[model samples]
Target: MAATETVAERPDYDPVALAESLASAADKSAKVLGDFIARQAAAGKSMVTDEFGLTQAFLELAAKMLSNPYRLAETQMNLWWEYSALWQSSMLKLMGQSTTPVVEPAKSDKRFRHEDWEEHFLFDYVKQSYLIAARWLHNTVANVEGLDEHTRRKVDFFTRQYIDALAPSNFALTNPEVFRETIASGGQNLVKGLNNLLDDIERGNGQLKISMTDSKAFELGVNIATTPGHVVFQNDLMQLIQYEPATAKVAKRPLLIMPPWINKYYILDLREKNSLIKWCVAQGLTVFVISWVNPDERHAAKDFVDYMLEGPLAALDAIEKVTGEKDANVLGYCLGGTLLAAALGHLAAKKDKRIVSASFMTSLIDFTGAGELEVFIDEEQVSSLERKMSERGYLEGSHMANTFNMLRSNDLIWSFVINNYLMGRDPFPFDLLHWNQDSTRMPAKMHS
Candidate 1:
């Protein structure tokens, strides 16, 4: 009867209400877009009027580029003629003829390494042509005028993304290694690759198959995260895991690791040898880690503020209770680090500084130079994302993983496509790759 009453007391979610709310938000987003564009137009007028910021910006760009314009052009021209010879020779090979050899670039650029790539008449031509085009595009962008520093940085970042996407290695036909593999495998590889492709398509539900990690080969807290730990505390957001002390004498300052909620906490305790948690235990420090909950619709309404309160703050409270230590050192990784920073700020504001020291690993405090990600971050794009999230209630881990894979399409996306789809090869079991594949969902409100 108690259980039944508890179940009945639970909040009743209304899909219709959610849809109406989303429609209203969409309407609001359109207004925001209009206001944003108007504000930009108004501020842009000041660039021409009050400060001449645009003129100054261009003048600075001009000074940076035109300092050695003549020498730059001459060097470019010479480089072009040199590559032209390679192209001419390659064209001869294509037409069933032969031509004399010419000097090639030393290629301190390590990415061009393919055994006898220069000797292969077809690949050599394709490779050198790509290099020349890439260099020209990069240099042209480097010298472009009329962009302010921030705008110029975004342009440069996106330009690099485009150039990387254009790399010959990304394509099955252009890549020399893939071509060799195709021959060596005698087309059986294509069959295997097709099978892999079909399997992913059949299972993936419209998501790209990135990692080929065999999930059955690994189990949590047994083979992978084998370090000894028990859940001492848990809240709506996460579980506070306190690892057993390895040394007889441990440090008074307990270490608490806060990994990004986007991934599992066991990344720190991946393997016994490579596990940072195990290493810290050996170093005679009491270690604690936060294993964030894989939230569903029940947590959809939770926001960043909720994460700050229930995540690190709750963990800190639990750590103090478990260890009887008022002060402890903290390590925050990536997105977790960002959350830690916000949480620390809030705690400090409230005069409750329990964390003695803090460490941030590869975290962002500012997005002044945020790379190609800027391309999809305009008002319209965000609104579209929110609408999608509103329908789902939360961002699926697969969806999040897809967006990240788009950031490095060549390595994370196409490499697998070539290996599993074109060459029909199986991927080896890599622990890191497995962790990467194991993504965690985020609440829509928090993610936004």
Candidate 2:
């Protein structure tokens, strides 16, 4: 106590560094504002569309809830009971007494994986409180009757999205890990996080395009898509890649792969250990893959019929020309599978047996169980999207990427929000995420 400590030994040291970081953050924030203003100005003359139609849907939801006051009362009563129990449990924990959580996160939920979420009393309380409220909200909306199926699904989907956005782990003040990082870094984490947020907004032209991976760490043909292949055929729709044979002798009929045009083909050939294209070639089969064009306004009029005619059908013709085989085995994935089914039907009608065998991977022939995606399929939303697409000639790849991210909002969207923005950490380089973030535009007719 008698000895005076130096400024270096003080816990609150380095005012200059902190001030510099804050100054840099302020500069970046100002730049962000300028960019946003420029974006709005550039879009001044563009027509605006209600892309989601969330307003009318929510109005109907509110109207239904008000019409059924007794149901609402019952739901509120149940929520109150849960909250009372949670309060009691939280008090017992505060007094160092054994207590059980009112609700636990799903086993697969990674947002609350930190030990502090369970070990720290306040964090535990926040987590359980949020879980209970979320459960009650989901159950109430899901049980809502009188609303049509599409409207009900839309309401339920968007409600979950709202709840996911409000999770404690997403906010630095509420997230224990982020909070600790903020304190340890003397709020520099926050300053850097601001810079990150501004960078993403600028990258998206004022929209928030979350960075999912270290994009610069990968390239198309260097580290990934490294399987030896050549563009044997190309047309307006796609480029057909023929991989070098791994064996002296190959299969009599080549294997033609039709990857989804909604994404690039490199997913199957991401790396050596996991490359499906390489694996197929090793099995003594000639592999042919369709790499769809990342279309632009020039391809606005290209339809599904054009895709079938020019995609798989054209590939089959080109394969015969190269390998001297009239028939070949075909495989399709996702949207490609849908196209394959249509092409098969078309060929069957023409009595064309060029396709000797067919395989489908995660294809959707029926829309009955379209799950959360059905939220975007209603007529109003579709029309709104079409209007937007008509002007641009194609739907932006990022728009579809964002839609898919919303399906797993906590995992794909909010988790990154916490790590990359709140915690001020760069996203780690990951192959699958790189692929996920490497989105391709969907042609207007094909997408619709």
Candidate 3:
């Protein structure tokens, strides 16, 4: 009886219990939201005006925000303190501790300093001015009457737009493909306009080449030399291997190629017709490719430093050894390009002067302007991810793949979903798609 009583006295607060409660709440919320959306669809109503739609959108955004454990924890901690302080005083009074003074710590000493009074006063004045202006606008809108139907509609539209703009739901997860398509479409239009203007300018001087060159033209016209008898050198880097020509007779100078570790080097060497590598070779450029080793559990201990030293530097050494050239032009694509920039910076700091010209393709440096990835790279999100990766020793390749897929959900993920799942059509084979499918694993250190 004593043992049973002791067992029964165990604390009720448990992590599993909290998790279950959260899941149940989430399930209920999802069900409610689904039903609301279904009702709106049945009614053939747009999401713009209906109160339920607005409310649902806000809830959805909130849910998305909460999905990030780090943000969720921070928010929860803040709310906890706010509510705790509110109730703490009452509880203390009820427990006969009211006579004891509750000393609240100062958040900032500057708030009390006399010198900062003017600054605080100015801030208060600006805040109050904004509040007064907002109230005036609200009152004016509420009192408006006898307006024409067109004017009323315009007002309604503006009001809805303002509310929607302020709604948190508007910031929820959006399809990346849609965003990319929009941007690309705009870019293409701009390019077309620019080209037309350029063509007009060139027409006055001579004949203008208005046509775009196909991949075949690049292969045949370029004079780098990829004939049958040409010898290409190969070197092994653990499980991976790199290939480059033994001698570049046509090339004026040696060129070093840095491919992203996320994908294989074969993208630049797909086939004779569409091979960028072959094109460069035909253009008289001495070329070398960096082949990244596919990582496994055993390679989890490797980090960014190891990749910097071994990957590009090793390729550089091989290029110099084969071509007898001390310096070479370096080109990097995407993540590889970013790594190359970092490596270059590191080398520059150390006063190393082996690199000549450097070129980057679709590579990100400053993340401040990163369009969609910001949703995933906030401090809270990264911290939560770090915790998970800490347990696994390394982040899995699938995780990185999923992130990229999410960035272009409409095109990379959902467009396929519609075609393959909804329409019941097989995926069409395209060279770009083929390359995308041939993704390589990122080493633990490089990934981190």
Candidate 4:
């Protein structure tokens, strides 16, 4: 059993007023949604209708499909030639004559081409065909005329996702290794995989579970988060955990870690070998970490400002009290790093320097060339999301997780669908995958 630590309530938080405050915020969010949707509806005509350039792009692509079979025809003939040569080599090897394949996967495409795939000629063909199809489709879309840059990129991103999801490697019949395993085991793996699928469906309440965490394999602060620590302070937003000193005499300066509230803090202290907290302790550094609260009805009112003031800001004060040091080295990860930046600015503005040095991991500082999320940022989408957030008072964790998963849906989603359902295989147990699955809700105000 995991040890239970004592918790102390935060001095600044008011539990009684939380309900009233959240209701007011939710009402405001709803009003914003109404105004936003009205404005969007009032806008003259959509770009898709008004823009002739987009219409021309589609027409050109369709015209090429009919008139210019030469490029596609040449490509098809080359693939058939490669397949014929490979088939001949496979037959010779099977009949006791040794021969190497005529075609090999390219250097850049090595990740998709596994050694096991090359061992079997049929698997090799499937792998090569999949890669070839992807490349052809990508080039075809890239060369299409008149489409604007943004639309082209979005189309390309989703097309890759679709192609990848349809990869032969994901299915047992198309994958020689999985087929062989099914035959050797007399379909026992499939039976076990089916059971795994059923369990996941039941666990997720009928949704095909995409996460790769084997939830039964580990427990927080038991097998993981096992670094000796005491929960020294708690608030509506976070818990300040003070890890025990690993050395007889610790560093005069302490370390304060702030992980993103979107994820649980145990990611840094996953297991003994991988735990950053344990590694720091071994180096004779006293470390204190902030474990964020998963928002529900009670925490729906807390905004980013609330988090900065009561979260890391309060943790710094508590760390100072415990270690008798006014300043501590601070480190933050992702959104946590963003929050830390806000806290630092606040402290600097107030002329209080409690943070000595800072380290950040995967923090978003620049938005230029802002990446794939731009497609979902239009006024209509924001209004839709805001309306939902207004009703719930917090944006569902699944919403954020699904959005992130779309960036690589084939691997993050469909691959698992094939494995867990079609192949009947359970999710592979991995720490990083586990952390990703353990998502937390964001307050509506903070989400804004």
Q: Quick one: best TM-score, which candidate?
A: 2
Q: Which lDDT tens digits does candidate 2 get at residues 1-448? A: 4356543444574779889878887887788878787777786643354678888988999898989999999999999999999999999999999998989999999989899999999999999999999999999988877999888988899999999998899898889999888877778788778888888988887778889999899998999999998999999999999999989999998999999988889889999999999999999999999999999999999999999999999999999999999999999999889999999999999999999999999899787888888888878878877887898899999989989999988889988998889999999999999999889998898778
Runs in model 1 with CA error above 4 Å?
1-84, 89-112, 136-166, 212-216
Give lDDT: candidate 4, residue 289. Answer: 92
> How do the residues 1-448 of candidate 1 rate in per-residue lDDT, one tens digit apiece?
9999967765565557555644654565465555555665764522233111234444565575677688568658867886877778778877877766554445564435776456678777777777777777676767666566555754565566678778776666787877767565444455556556655653554333554666567788778999998999998899998899999999998998999999888888889889999999999999999999999889999998999889888888888888788888999999889998998899899998798899999888788766666655655556766776786678888877876876776667766766676666777777777888898888889877
Q: What value of lDDT does candidate 4 attain over all alpha carbons?
A: 0.73
- Cα deviation of 168, candidate 1, in Å: 3.7
Q: Which ten residues in a row have the lowest lDDT in candidate 4?
A: 1-10
Clashing pairs in 2: none
lDDT of each: 0.74, 0.90, 0.52, 0.73
The TM-score ranking, best first, is 2, 4, 1, 3
Q: List the residue pairs that clash in candidate 4.
A: 193-424
Candidate with the larger TM-score of 2 and 3: 2
Q: Which is the leading candidate under lDDT?
A: 2
Report model 4's TM-score to 2 decimal places.
0.74
Model 3 regions lying over 4 Å from their true place? 1-248
Give one digit per residue, the lDDT tens place, for model 3 in 39-73. 66875656564311234334444454455667556
